[model samples]
Target: MARLAQVTSSRNREVVAGFDNYADAERAVDSLSDKGFPVEHTTISGVGLRLVEDVLGRLTYPKAAGLGAVNGLWIGLLFGVFLALFTTNAVAWFAVILWALLWGAVVGAVAALIWHALSGGRRDFLSASQLIADRYEVLVDPAHAERARELLQTSQS
Candidate 1:
């Protein structure tokens, strides 16, 4: 926790520039780096952060099964690769992997169906959430603030 506090400490830093979006702030930092500024002393802080969730669609049993199947398929493939290493025959190796994948998919689908049924329609939607900020501020240590401002001004001109 001490290390984390040290890393995130902004005690003597001042905002050199502000932007409505992250891209502009990133570009400013890139400019500073290109101009040989001490980029290590700089940090981009997002202001007024909020969580935005976009509902993709309704969650159904079929969609849940499909998602579970894909996840299980990857797990099966990984395990199959490890198990196949023990087999020397080409035919046996292929057969083992194929069987593992099939079993994984069937098991995953059944499990997802059972889980969906148990949910009792309490939560039944698909959505993605993102943390966004109203503005991005580029801050620099007080000691380097003057040089950073000069470089940013020249770059903008």
Candidate 2:
């Protein structure tokens, strides 16, 4: 005999606690898990989201060229290895790899230099962007919501 599995609807899920930050919500969930609560039944949600951009550093021609050259070097090395597999001679394999790496670095550096020069100082800064939330909520299945809240409260005490 095959038994049907139980499915809990979204309506049966409710928010047990709200936190000002994601770490706090995560800690709350961890506490619930430590208390033998089913951690899988819990979920974290961010509310009141905002996009933020943080400047890392100024981007210069030298930096841009260096980045391009490093990327090109790796790509060229990979291509060389792939090409080497098709050749039967050991010397040809080494020759192909050397030539590929040299050309790749030269081409990549030149290309990036040209690109940076063409930008004319319009966008010269490097930055990281992410979406951040003002608050994070811990939600759990209705059956476990009360227990989760109790566990979280006890942990804080």
lDDT of 2 by residue, 4-110 (tens): 22233434678999999999998888888888999878878888999999999999999989878987888889898889888889999999999889877878888
What TM-score should be assigned to candidate 2?
A: 0.63
lDDT of each: 0.90, 0.85
Model 2 lowest lDDT segment of ten:
1-10
Return the top candidate by TM-score. 1
Q: Which segments of candidate 1 are over 4 A away from where they belong?
A: 1-3
lDDT of 1 by residue, 44-144 (tens): 99999999999999889999899778877877888887899999999989988998898788778888888888999977888999999999999999999
Candidate 2 deviation (Cα RMSD): 6.2
Error of 1 at 95 (Å): 1.9
Candidate 2 error regions (>4 Å) = 1-12, 57-60, 76-104, 110-122
For model 1 the TM-score comes to: 0.87
Q: Give lDDT: candidate 1, residue 18.
A: 95
